[model samples]
Structures are given as structure tokens and as C-alpha cells.
Target chain A: MTSPPAVRLTALTRRFGEVEAVRGLDLTVDRGEIVAFLGPNGAGKTTTLDCVLGLSQPTSGAVEVLGLPPREAVARGLVAAVMQTGGLLKDLTVGETVRYVGSLFGHADRSSAVLEEAGIADLAGRRVGLCSGGEQQRLRFAIALLSDPALLLLDEPTTGMDVEGRRAFWAAIRRDAARGRTILFATHYLEEADQHADRIVLISHGRVVADGTGAEVRALAGGRSVRATVPGLDETLLGRLRALPTVDRVEARGEQVHVHAGDSDLVARHLLTATDAHDVEITSRNLEDAFLSLTQEAR
Target chain B: MSTPTHPADAYDPAGRTPPRWGGFNRTLLGLELRRMLRNRRTIVFTILLPAGLFLSFGSTGQASDRVGSGNVAAYIMVSMGLYGAALTAAASGAMVAMERSLGWSRQLRLTPLHPAAYVVTKTLVALAIGAIAIVAVNVTGLLQGRPDMPAGTWVACAAVTLVSTLTFAALGVFAGYLVPGENVMQILGPGLALLSFLGGVFIPLDVGSTIWHIAVLTPMYGVAEVARAPLTHELPWYAVVNAVGWLLAFVAGAAWQMSRDTARV
Candidate 1:
């Protein structure tokens, strides 16, 4: 028999007046794993995270974090969150904010170490409001880590961060995961999930439509791409390629002909022989393509 | 081959634990006291306002042989204490309101800090502010050589003032919680003004007939009646009991509303 997950949702449902923000959503995040929640704006990503953080109550069903009810887990200092807005006091210096939060969790020295680990040691004296968005995000992460919580929920953690900042943030998360912390993060940026998540759950219209490993979910897109730099690509050949049984879509840009099809290898061989196309390149489908395809298919 | 240890694994020392609360209320009270003292605006309004008003009132009776003239000077001195209580209550409410607006309360709710701790912190902060206001009022009044009220009267008056501040602070918290942010100032401004006037903070409760009777039934009126008994050497058992009762009711009501609100969120 398997042990229970670090975080689990059993048919969770939350309604706000007339609208259902989250509906009968079931998920489980195992210990020492990073699960990325993928969704667009107003897709109930934040709402679900709020439920997990005990910031919002589910209208029906139940949620458990670290084997306890969400609110109970929070009271026990078993859960931590890095919200999109950072949520640090503006008047307080970075060090002061960390210390204040640490005191709340009954840990003072742990905050300083978390700050150092997040690479914001030099920013201790700066007021939280004066720091840049990336700096504030790092500080929020540091504060969340102060309690050594069993579950960490990050809602759009890298929304405002630049590319480099995001890379560093993910690296930190990976480090934490390696030490047996469970992380459930939500992000609209598919690349973050693709690069980091052990499993990905895709939500739309307050429901989970896809849940699997990166490769498994990508397979839901059901096709690969074949890009060929053909010497002469004409509309007639493009039409012929588009008519093939395996082909999903066809695009012609300058000297290159890109084909979206079910089997790129099979399509590439046919394209090479049929159009005498050379310089063929076959690439695996990316998360962006998979997401668009999946969402479109759901619609 | 040995596995590479991650940065998070470096602190894998077993059996490390953090400290828990010794006495929950005392720790919360001490923290609240520190916060109140550190707040510059609270210090100014609580401490400075009382001193300023006392000086303005005390200087008038300094030249007169008859200290308790029951005129503007006496009225101002008494009113100064009432104002101090009102200001402390208002400041307490504003601080809690500001915390809610800034999401601090919601964040704090996630911690091991109990609901009682949060409420006690606010109450203690208000009490500390009230103490400062009372001391400033008495010191300024004494410096001006206004006939010193009896020590027993001062003690009675301070107790009533503290209770009144507590009651008003709870009401302020309720108002801050119920009212929307855009209309906070408008709601609190008119309501506080009316309480101050009707409760006899500025004008004596005996000025009107039917209106005076009705105003005396108000929470502030009960506060003022109890607070002034010590100064006037006219301690009324009914007034003190009523004031204490109202303070308890306000605290109970505010706590109920806040806890319900927190649970809903």
C-alpha cells in the first residue's frame, strides 16, 4: 500500500455567489515532488491554491495538506505560501519582514538562513517596497521557507520575474524539492512547468482536463512537427501536403515548409520523397503546442 | 557512487526545534506594547494631544484663584481626558483596519497566533496608549497648578478612561471591519464626532432635557459619566457598572464578528 500524498484534494468545490471558482477538482501532490498547475487567467488556479493555503474555504468537498485539513495544517505551521503580490509589509526592511514572519512561526534564525539561500543577503536593510519585483519575490520565498513547512504553495511565483530571475527561482525550488519539501505551484508560463514539474495538472473552466508527466501530457497534443528547408515550396505542394492523412496543419514561410502532423518521422520521409525536400529537421512537440492543442481539443 | 547533497540538505541536523510561547497572553501583550510604543503617529496622538489640550486648559485656571470654575477651563481639562480616550480608541481601530487593508491580518491568521492573541494585542495597545494619554493629561494639569484632584479621584477617573478607551477601540474595530475602504474616513469621521458630542466629551451631558437623557444612554456617555465621577468626587455605582458592562459587550460583539469574518474568508 502507498502512503498518503503530502497534499490531497477530494472532489474539492468552491463557489462565490453564482459562480463556481473550483468544481469537484481532485489532485494529489506527493512528498518531495514539484507539481505545476497550468491554467490561463480566471481558470481557478489561484482559487485552488487559496484552498490549499487555507486562505479560502471550499464550498463543498475537502482538502488536506500534510495529512491534515488545510486550515488545521496552517495553524500547525505545516503550510507556507509565496503569493503573487509578495505580501510583505512596505515599511519594514527585508530583514525586519523576515524576522517578523519568522517570529510568527516561532523561528528567528531560520529566516536569515533562508534569506541567504535565496541570494538576498545584501538586501537585508532595504525597505520591502523599495526592492524590485524580482527581489520582493525572492524575499517572499525566503519568508515562506522560514518555517520549514511540509507543503509550499506558490501562486504564479514567476509572473513578474525576468528570465534570469525565473531560472534562479526554479533552481531554488529544485533545491528545496531535493530536500523532501512538496511544492505545488501555479503558472501560466508553460515553460516553467515543462522545465521543473515532476507532474503537471492543466485546468480550464474550474476543472482539471489534463494531469500527467510532461511527456504524457505533451502526448495529448497527438502530433509532432517537421520543418524542411525545401529549395522551392509552392502553394500546390503545400496543398498536397495538407491533404495527407497524417498532417494536422501546414505553413510555408519563405524557403521553409513546416508541417504539423501525427508522426513527424513518417511525414518527413514522405515529404522528402514527394517534394524532394532537403534539410529536414524533426522536433518533439513543446509544452506550448501541447497546451494550445489540448485546450483547443477540450473546446 | 555517492549522491550529491543539495543545499537544503545541509541543515539536516535532527531534533532541532523552535521555542513555543511561555505565557500566550503575556508574550502577545509585550509584543503589542512594543508595537504601540514604536508607532510614531500613535505616540503623537495619544501622548502629545492630551498634553497639548491640558496645557491649553490648565493655563486658563493658573491665573484664577478658584481652580474648578465649572467654566471653559474645567470643561476643557475634563474634555481633554475624554478626547484622549477617544483618540486612543480611534487609533486602535485604524491600526487594525490598516492591517486588514494591507493583508497583514490574513497572513497572521495562518500562524500559530491565536485569535485571542490578536484581539489581546489590539486591546493592550489601546490600553498602553490610554495610559500615556492619562499621564500626559495629569502631568500637564498639575504643572499649571490647577487644584489637584484627589489621588483616589485620579485613580477612579483613569480606570473609567481606560475602560472607555477599550470599549471605543472595539467599536472602531467593528466599524473598520464592516465599512468599505473607500468610505472609511467618512463613516468614522461623522460617527466619532457624534459620539464625542453626544457622550459629553466636549459639552456636558446635562445641557439638554430629553436629548441629554437619550445621549446619556449611549456607550460614550456611560464612559464619560464613570470617568468624570473621580474628578468631581461623585462616584456613581450605576455609572461604573454600566460602563464596565458596555465594555464587555463591545469586546464580545467585536470578537464574534471578527471570528465569523475570519472563518468565512
Candidate 2:
């Protein structure tokens, strides 16, 4: 039989006095699936992650991981997390921090392999306070691996990393995912989610507004836009194009008309034959535009 | 969607599933112990401060002065020993406040380390620091003209001093919860010193005096009186009740604050 999903959140709602941080959030992740939660800041992404990690109790709802409560999974070494920052001992050296966490999880002897995997073996003697932000995040990744956990949760793990450092960090995470570890990360960076996550869940206003693959999420905001140079553009012809089944929206700028076409072929044929239209140009919105369009629509 | 009802509730942090972690992690214990010792401030408070007080107050012409049944040196030694032990223990325990403020405690919560184990480890490490202070003062007393006493008196005084340090260890945690990271130790240091003086840990007070009456109500009064029992050879009834009372009070206060803080996260 297949194993239970790595995580399940059912109608999760969290309210802090007057503010509802998360409202009716439902999500599920099968084992070994690499999922990324994408949202703008204050979109309830952190609140959702906090609920999943059992760090904060929901005002009304539940979060389960690996067929157990978040706390129980956490206690069984089945769950591990690498938070953005501020959860590590500043006074302890890299090696000391890693070793201390290992001992806490009954893995008192896992420093060398995990440290190498996290790419921090050389900085073992450096105190966490002395390490750069990127270096500290790498050390945190090493500590997260001490449990040999089946699932890993990262919250904006590369908030301070430069381009090259972020590439290396994700490379390490990719290797872990290759080993069949279920991975979930929350990030506001659109490119990171598009490139790294297999499945993207876009949250806004404490709710999932879009859930799909990167291509699908892009498709939600993009379609073929046909700009046609139609001579003698009259009100009657423009009205005809606007009502066509293939044309989602139509706009006219002087004699040139722009039509957002769900099917460019149909709109092109209509414009060419049904009217004295010619010189049609087609373009598609990039992911950047799609992201803006989708997020703006949610608001 | 319903919640997962797994059997792993056995690990519910209340000692229900103690076997998983064996109720303690030795590696963590060793690391905490080593880190506490490496701190220069801990060494100063646990060793230098107490030893200095012992030399300055327990020696000189007063060594022959009698209080109750023992000489002045024995009385002052027990009092100074109690101060050092309590200082070391409480100071160590209060470090948790800084850790929490730094978010280190939140990080640990994500691990399989039992929550109760965190408290146990802090208390254990505090006791370890308190032990060093207790030993250092006793040795200072032995070398620096302490009251000559029977073997049982020395052993009992040491035992009381060691055990009574728990009160301060718990009190430190309570204080830690109430204060911020930068001021937890700073505030507790001067506060505990004042409490020591008022509670008669620094000097003997007449039985029926107003200050002594007020002293009996302070936390130090109870533990100090108990530690000095072997030296004075009189275990006052009020002293025993006070020791147990403050121990329970501090423990309850710390546990309550810790639960609230952790939950708030």
C-alpha cells in the first residue's frame, strides 16, 4: 500500500485576536513530492508553515505530517525544518551546533556526513555569530539533516544569499530530494518557486488562490495577444471581434487593434477574412508578467 | 479532512514514552556542561566571588566569636557557601532566557529532544556550576582558617549547601522568564545579593528582631538557615517550611512562565 501523505492540512484557520493570519487553508503533500508555497509577504505563507511545523497551534483546524500530529512527527525524527534565521545558538561553533542538535535527536554521531552534505565542513570551527548569513543558513541545513528526516521544511532559507550561494544551496536541496525525501519550502521569490518547485501553491489573503505546476500557473495569467493593423477600423468590426468566442478581450488604439486571443488562429482568421485586417503580430506574457497579473487579480 | 490519530502520542512530552530518548541525552548533557564551564563570567561568580567573600568575612578576630554553638568562622562559611552555590545555580539556569530571546530554544523545539529534558538539562548544568562553587568555598574555608569542626558537621553543611542550591536554580528560571536577555543576569545578580544580606545569609540576626522577622520571609532566609543548620546545630522549624515553600513557589512560577512563552510561539 502507498504510504500516507507527508502532510495534510484540512481547513486550517488561524486567528490572532483581530487579525486572521490564515483562513481555511487546506493542503496535502504526498511522500517524496517537492512542493513550494509561493506568496507575497503577509499573505499567510509563514502562518501556514508555522502551523505545519507545530510551532503554533491553529485557532481552529489541524495539521498532520506522515500520518501523525506535527508534534509527534517532530518527536519521531520524521520531520525536520530549516527556518529562515534566528534559531541557532550564536555562541556555538558550527561543529558544536551541528553536534548538539545531532545529540538531541539521538544521532550523536552524524556531524561529518551531514556537514559535508550541507557544504560547511570547512567552517566547522567558526562560531555562528561569526559566520555570514549564507554560511549560517548552510549550517542550519546541516543541522536539519541530523534527523535523517523523511521530510524537510524550509522557510525562506536563502533570504540573505547572493546568486551563486543560492544556486549552491538549492543544489544541495535538490540532491536531498533526489534521495526520496519529501520537501516543502516557502518563498516570496517568484523565480525560485518557478525553477525549483515541482508543484506550486500560490497563497493570497490567507487562502490558496492558485495551485498548479509552474507552466499551469503561468497559463492562468497568459494567453496569445494578437495585435492587428486593420485599415479603416470601424466601431461595427471592433464590436464583432469583441464578441467572438476565441477573443477574451479586445482593445483599439487608433487604426491598430489589439486582441487577447484564447486561440490566436481563430482570431487571426476572423480579423483577416471578416474584416480588412492585415499584419497581425502575436506575443505571450512571460512568467514575470503572469506572476504580477495573478497576484494583482487576487487582491 | 480529519487529523492524524497515530500511535505516536506515546511521545507526548509528559514522560509517557521515556524509552525513546532514555529520559536524557548524555551528549547534550556533556555539551551543556562544557559550555557552562567555558564561560568566564560563570567562573568568576561561582569561584572568585564566593571565595573572596569567605576570606573577607569568615576570617580575622571573629573566627573565635561564637554564634549559637559554633564559632564565627563556621557560621560565616556556611553563609558564604550558600551564597556562592545559589549564585552559580541561578546564574546558569537564567541563561535560558537569553537562549529563548535568541531563538535557540525555538530551534530545539523542532527536534526530537523532549521539552521536559530541556528543563532537566538546565537544572542539571546549574547544579554542576553550583557544585564547583560549593567545593571552592569549602576548600577556601579549609585552607583559610575555617572553624575546626567534627567530620559530620563538615559533611552535613556541604550536603545542605549543595541541595539548597536547587531553590536558586529554579528561581533563576523564574527570573529569566520575567526579564529580557541582556538584563536577566545583571538584575538577578544585584537582586540576589540584596536578598542575601536581608535574609541573614551574610550576618546573624537576633531571633526576635524586626529585620530578622522580615528576613525569614525572603527566599534566601530559608535555604541559608537550612545550610547553616549543621554549623548552628539547630534546625529551626520555620527554616524547613520556608525552604520547601520557596522551592515549590519558584518551580511553579518557572514552569508556568515557560509554558506560556513556548505556547506563544
Candidate 3:
């Protein structure tokens, strides 16, 4: 039989006391596929990643990484991760951190190469505490590369990075993917998912809301939101907007009203002519709009 | 991005051998030892404090009074040595609290490192620190040359002191998992000092006295009695029971807390 998918989660559910953080989520990612896990805050992305890393156990359901249990795969050095924050010791220099983790894998000599790949070769002598947030993130990335894992998991790996740093980081990741490494990353930046990921798995409230290519996800969301400053938006106007046959969601924020509908031109015309709306704008949907609409629908 | 030049065969997981010892390599242990030794607090609490206490209090004992195989000064020296080793081991073990707070333990879990291996490594590191404290006190005793003990007795006292201090190392790990990172040593430091006083490590208590009966039950009492056995030539069954019982209890406690720690979100 051919090797199993890089990662597979079947009906994964995790609970924290009374709070059900992850509820019956399912997903599968093939080898060498760059899958982006997209979700809003508190959408169980980190929780799911933790389970895949075996840092936390699933209350129910099965998680497989590299055709084996998560912990087993990890222990075999087939899986590695770059977690979000606070893993580095403040006292050790960057080189020492990389070397120390490398030693755990019996590959201390590879530290310099990984550091160079992570664009932190010059930072070897800098103490982790003294490094900037972006620098620290790069250091974490370097440490993850020490084992040359087959499947890599990154949880918000570039959160604190600068624009240039983010660019360089993705370059390194792309190079790894080209080497047949399966990469799964959880990120808040929709643009990163759109630009880099071959597939996007969007989760909301511990469930997969959408899973496809970026364009496919956007097409699946399939609507534009007409946003305008409405001075007198009341329940009557909201009700009227909700009554529209084409509209999917009607939301109000401060003096602005957002009406999501398939026909944005018709919606914009209705707002400009039929109601007292200013700054009437009709815009095409982007990944952000798609992310918001999909997650909103899940809720 | 540069394309990977190597063929996909290089990515095969089957080609690699799994790490031995559950990722408990000597390199990690070496790094841990260096970090602990570099900590100024470790030096002050483990080495200087014990030696300083021995100098200050041990000097007051009359050199003429003989207790068992050595003079009163030597008995006090052994007691101080045991006290230092226990404190050092416990403090070293509790360093896990800091590692946990830093999320380092979580990171290690993501690696191939087993929880048992982590504990074993930490315990071994603690034992190493305990050895240093014993050596510091014994060397201080040797320089003074007033303890009046045979070379064999000194060797025996140091060895027993180092080995029995493993109880405190286990206790430290248990407390490390029990309390928050910043407060672990704060609570354990005073707690150990109190145990020392109760165990009669710092003072002589009459046999069968009310305090002596309570002392025999304290964790440190047995360790103190056992370490000083070479110098004092007295061995009680109850002291051995106390030492062994606490060791098992602390190890179990540490294991339970470690399981819970790994299961946490």
C-alpha cells in the first residue's frame, strides 16, 4: 500500500472542563501539500495543532501524523513543530538554542546550516531574550529544521515577523515543501494562506467550515458584502435588508451597515436609491471577505 | 525560493533510525548542567550557604567532646553537609518549574523526548548538584582539620549524603509541578529549612524526647541520621524507613504531576 496522508484527523474532539474547544473536526492533508489552517481567534486551530503535536491528547477521535500516532511519529523524528511563543530559554544564545535542540536529534553540526536557512546565522551569539520578536521566531524555525522532519507543523509561525522577515521565512518554507516535506501551518493572515498554501482548511467553532484551494474557498463563499455609512439604520431598515432574496447576511457596526449578497451591484443600487446610504461602494470579494463570510456562516 | 536539488528519496522517514534513549542524550544533560551551574542563585543556596552555615555554627561546637567515631565538630560537619546536599538537590529538581513556565517542557514534548527521560535527566542533574554541595562542605571540613574523623568516615559520610539527597531531588520535581514557576523555590527554601530544624540537623535532641520522636518522622531526619551514621555509628530502622518512604512518595507525586502537566492545554 502507498503511504498514508501526511496528516489525518477523524472526528477529533477536545474539551477543556465545560468548554468544548474542538468539536468533531475532520481533515486530511496529503504529502508535500502546503495546507493552511485558517480560523478566527478561539476557533480551535491551536488546540488542534497541539493534539497533532501530541502536546495535548484528544478527548475523543484519532489523529495520525505520517501514518502513525502523533507521538510515535514525533518520537521517530518524522514530525517537528514551530509553536507560537515562549518556547525558547531566555538565557541561551541563539546558536546554543539551535545546537542544544540539534543535539537532542544527534545532529548538532546541522545547527549552522539551519540557522543560515532561517536567515539568522549572524544571530548565533545573541541571547534569546535580547532578540526581537521576529528574530526569536526565526530562531524557533531554525530549531524545528534540526531534525529534517518529514512533516512540519507551524502554529502562527510568523506572527511577530516584519514584512521582509515574513517573506524570507516563506521562501525557506517553500524550499522545504519542494523537497517533499508536508507543511501544515495555522495562520491569522488570510493573504499568507492565499499566496502560499496549496489548500486552505478554514475552521470555525471547532468545525471545518471550508476546505479547498484559496480561489475555490472564495468561490464557495460566493458573495460580496455592500458596506455603506447609514446614518439612520434601524430595525426596520435591517429587517428590510434581511428580506432581500439575494442577501445572505446583514450586519451593522456603528453607523455602517454591511449587507452580504451575491449581486453586489443590485444591493448597492438599492442602498443608494432606495435608502439614505452614503459612500455606497461595490467591491469584489477577496480572501479576507471570503474568510469572514465563511466563518460567519459556520457560527 | 531556490528549488531543492535532492531527489525525493532524501525525504523518506524509513531511512532514519529513531533516536535512542527517548531523546535523553548526554548533550542535553550537559547543557542543563551548565545552565544550572551558571545560575548565581544555585551557587549561593547550594554551595556558599551550606559552607557558610557550617563555618558559623560548626565552629561553636567544643573540639574536645567526642560523639561516636568523631568529635562534636565532625558530627556538625556531616549534618551541615547533608543539609546542603538536600537543599541543592531539591532546588535543582525544582528548576523544572522555570522550564515549564517558559514553555520549554511543551517544546520538549513536541520532540522525541519522553517524559520519563526528562525526569531522569533532571533527577541526575539534581544528584550532580547535590554532589557539589557535599564536596564543598567536606572540603571546608578538611581545610579546618578540627572535625577529627578518619578518612574512611569522611568518604562514607559524603557518599551517603549525596545518595540520600535524591529524596529532595524528587521532592523538588514534585513541588516544581505542584507550584508556579517563580514561587517554587520561595516555598521550598523555607519549607526545607523548617524540615532541617525539625529533623535536628542543626541541633542535638535527647533520645525518646517529644521533639526527637517527631524528628524521626520528618523527611530530613532520616537523611541526617543516615549520612552521619559513619561519624555517629548509630543506625535506626525507623530512620531508614523514613528516608525510603519519602523517596517513593515524592517520586510518585512527581510522576502524577508530570502526567497531568503533559495532558494540559
Candidate 4:
């Protein structure tokens, strides 16, 4: 038997006067899964999340969280959200904020445990507004986890964080996922999605353009690039490199000539035999390339 | 093999069922009350401001003159109390506007708490604050050689204060919602104060002309009239009806606007 979805949106649409913020967006998140929602600013990512959280009603669609409406699910303590601003009471201490949120879910001790888990136990007595942005983010994460919610809705979970902070944050998210909590997060950070998401859903212009694994979405770019830095290169060799069947495009910058090809290894092997080709370094196509290609294709 | 389910999981501990009054409303009320109490300035303004005004106004006339005649001291005491009520109403409106401007209301809206709870909580906070202000004013008046009005009048005043607070709180909420953040106080504070003064909170209705008569048609006038009736024993039926009507109108208008706001979000 298949487990029920943590959240499901069927043709969800939200209109703000003449402008349609979210249009016919259908999506689902299952228990114990991490789904990343990728979209540019004003692409209905937040609106969709708001709808699933029951903060906003769909203009013409239905949304369910843990087999109930979003508001019902929230009352039942089945869903928790970590919004962009963290939504914490500024005057309250960290512990107080967590306890307040936990009390709403009928669990007080859970707040402390969640706080410790989020690595902010020492700052429990500190006021939330006095804390740094990263600290506030962690506090929100702790609060979101206080209810032991089955589903977590995180919007831009780590937008402004140092490299190490983001890694630690991702570790906490992974820990939560390990405990069987389904997470659906919207973020512009492609690397976070690529590294942590079990599945990614790309939204643009108030619609879902792509939904698949990191590798699957990357495959949407068709082929990979064979970027090589040759110590010495000539136009004859560049022309010869571009003539390769696997090579789609070629650009020469000074002594280094970069090649976009279906097979990087084959291109590198052919480049090694060239008279002026020396010290050729081939790299894999990253998510940036895939994202640019996908967004371009979407447009 | 046995499937394990936690004891807390078997039964909904938080009473997962939709509350008769709704959790959102309760939570909203809870948060609003806590926030209001937490602010030292708000507490001082809500409780002390009216009390001080009433005491200063009440002490001007000797206690013997205030006994049966219900002279200017008693009259001004009632008016000052009404002024406090108006201030409370204006403050409540400003508070809501400030909360919205600071994004606190939006944050609360994202919670599982129901929308009705949010509205009800805010209304209750305003009412509670208004009651505190009214009590402070009357208690101070009593201490300043002004004897208490009859229990019946006191109860009537309390009831009036409650209804007036509700009506003004609703108006405040509407103002907060409608007014832009930067111009909230500029629009609501002076606007409410002007209405209150015109409605006879500052100047007596009998002293003013056709405009004051027109002002008596406002919600604040009705509230002031109802509040002063027990103390002065001069109940104006038309003013009471007008206040009740305005209160109902504010409620309807607020409900409509809130529903539209929520739907738009």
C-alpha cells in the first residue's frame, strides 16, 4: 500500500486583481520525501506554498495536507512552516518562542529537544530579534520541527547564509527527513536543490515547467560540456576540435579552448593527440548550465 | 509483528477537531493580549492617561457641589472617561496598523490559527484595553473627592464602554487595513480624536451647533451618550440607537473587508 501524500495541490490558482500570481499549478509531496521547488521571484512559488499552508485560498483549485485541508492540518499539528522571515515573535526569547509554538501543538518539551537539534540550545534564552539572520533561521527551523510535523513547508530556507552555515542547515534538514518528515521547500539556490532534494519541481511564469531528479533535470540540457584548458592551442586545432562529432560548440580564449560536447572524455582524448594540445582539463556540466538551458527552454 | 503507535498519536491531544470558536481566533487573541501587556507604553497610555485626565478634570469642582447637582466636574469626568475610551479606540487602531506595518499580522495569518480567531482576538484586545482605561478613569475620579455614581449607572457605563470599544476597535481595524502604513496615525488618530471631540467627549453637545448635532450621528457620539446616561441620568435614545447602528455598520464593513483581504491573499 502506498503512503498518503503529505501535501497535494490540484490545479491550484491564485489571482491578485488583474494579475494571476499562480496559475493551474498541480503538485504533490509524499511522506519522508524532500521536494525542492525552484522558481524565480514572483513565479508563484511563495503563493503555492501559502495555499498549501492554508494562509491563502486558491482562486480555482483544491489543496490537501495530510488528507485534510491546510488549516485543518495545521490545527491537527500535521504541518509546520519555516517562512522567509522566520515568523518568530521578536520580544520573546528563543525558548519562549519555541515553547509558544510547541504549546500550540500540545508539546512543550519537544521545543527544547528541537532547539538542541537545531544547534541553538545555548541561545535559548536570547531574544529572537537580537539574534543574527542565520541564528533566526535556525530558530525558525527549530520551531517548525517542534510539533513533529509530518509535513514541513520551507520557503527560501537558506537564502542568505555563509557556505558552512548552509551546510549545517542542510544537515539539520537531512536529519528531519531521516525521521520521516516530508519537506517541500522553495528556493532559488540550485545547489541546495541539487544536493538535498529527492525530486525537483521547476516553476516559471506561474506554472510547473520541469519535475524530476537532479540528474533527470540536468539531462534536460541534452549533452554535457568538455571544458579544457590547453597550454598551447592554435586556430587549426580549434577548428579540428570543433569538427569533432561530439562537439556542439567551441570557444577559444587565449591559450585555452573550451569545448561543449556530448562526451567530454572523447573530446579530451582527441585533443591529447593534437600538436599544440597540452594540459587539457575536462570538467562535468554543473547545475548552472542545466538551469540556464532549462530556463531558456522554458521561456 | 506489532504496529506501534504512540499514546499521544492515538488521540488528538490538541483537540484536532475544529474548535467551536476556532483555534486561530483564540491564538490571535492570545498573541494580541500578550503583545499589548508586554508593551509598557501601551499599558501606561491605556490605563493611566484617562485616569489622569478624569482626576484633574474631576478635582476642579468641590465635592459638595458634585453631590446631587451633577455639575461641570461630574460632567467633565464623564466626558474625560469618554475621551479615554476614544483614545483607547484610536490606540487600538494604531496598534493594529503598526502590527500590520511590521508584518506581524501577516506572520500570524500564516499560522494554522483560523482567520476568525485573528479578528476576534484583536477585537477582544481592544475591548479589554478600553475597559482597563475606563476603570482607571473612574477609579481615579472616585479618589479625587468625586463619589461613585449609582451601581446601575456604573454597570451601564461599563456596558457602554464595552460596546463602544468593540465599535471603535472594529473601526480601528478597518482604518488599519485601509490606511497606508506611513499615514496611519496621521489619518486615524486625528480623525478619531476629531470625531470624539465633535461627538461631545471634549465639548458638551448642548454647547455646540448643527455640526455637533451632525457629529452626534457618529458611532462615538452614541458610545459617549450611552456611557454618560447612567452618570448624568440624561439618556438620549437617538444617540444610543445611532451608536448601535454605527457599531453594526463598522462590524459589517470590517467583516467584508477582512474577507476580501484574506481571499486576495
Report clashes for each candidate as comma-separated counts: 0, 0, 0, 3
CAPRI verdict (incorrect, acceptable, medium, high) for model 3: acceptable
Clash list (residue pairs), candidate 1: none
lDDT minimum window of 10 residues, candidate 2 chain A: A284-293
What residue runs in model 2 are displaced by over 4 Å at the alpha carbon?
Answer: A275-279, B1-19, B67-69
How do the residues B1-265 of candidate 4 rate in per-residue lDDT, one tens digit apiece? 1125422232232445433444433443565677667777667667786777666656664533543335556666666766666666666765665565555556555445565655566667777877777777767767775655666666676666666677777776677678746466567656876887778776666635788668877767888877777666766678879878988887787677666765555
Q: Relative to the true interface, what fraction of contacts does candidate 3 keep? A: 0.56
Q: Which of candidates 1 and 3 reaches a greater lDDT? A: 3
Writing each residue's lDDT as its tens digit, candidate 2 over A1-299 gives: 34567889999999988999899989999766789899888989888888888998999877988778888877777788888879888778899998888887664488999999888899998888899998988888898888777788999988888788788889988877776688899988888898999999888888887888888887777577889899999899899898888678889999999999767778888888888888888887666677677777877
The alpha-carbon RMSD values of the candidates against the true structure, listed in the order shown, are 4.8, 4.2, 5.2, 4.5
For residue B111, model 1's alpha carbon misses the true position, in angstroms, by 1.9
Highest DockQ: give the candidate number. Answer: 2
Give the Å error, residue A251, model 1: 8.7
* Cα displacement (Å) at residue B241, model 3: 2.0
For model 4, the superposed segments whose C-alpha errors exceed 4 Å read A10-26, A59-62, A106-109, A162-164, A227-259, A263-282, B1-21, B24-31, B62-72, B182-190
Better of 1 and 2 by TM-score: 2
Model 1 per-residue lDDT at B196: 70
After the best TM-score superposition of candidate 3, give how far the Cα of residue A261 lies from its true spot, in angstroms.
Answer: 6.7
**Cα error of candidate 1 at position A255, Å:** 13
Q: lDDT tens string, model 4, A16-39?
A: 889898889888876778999987
lDDT, candidate 4, residue B157? 66
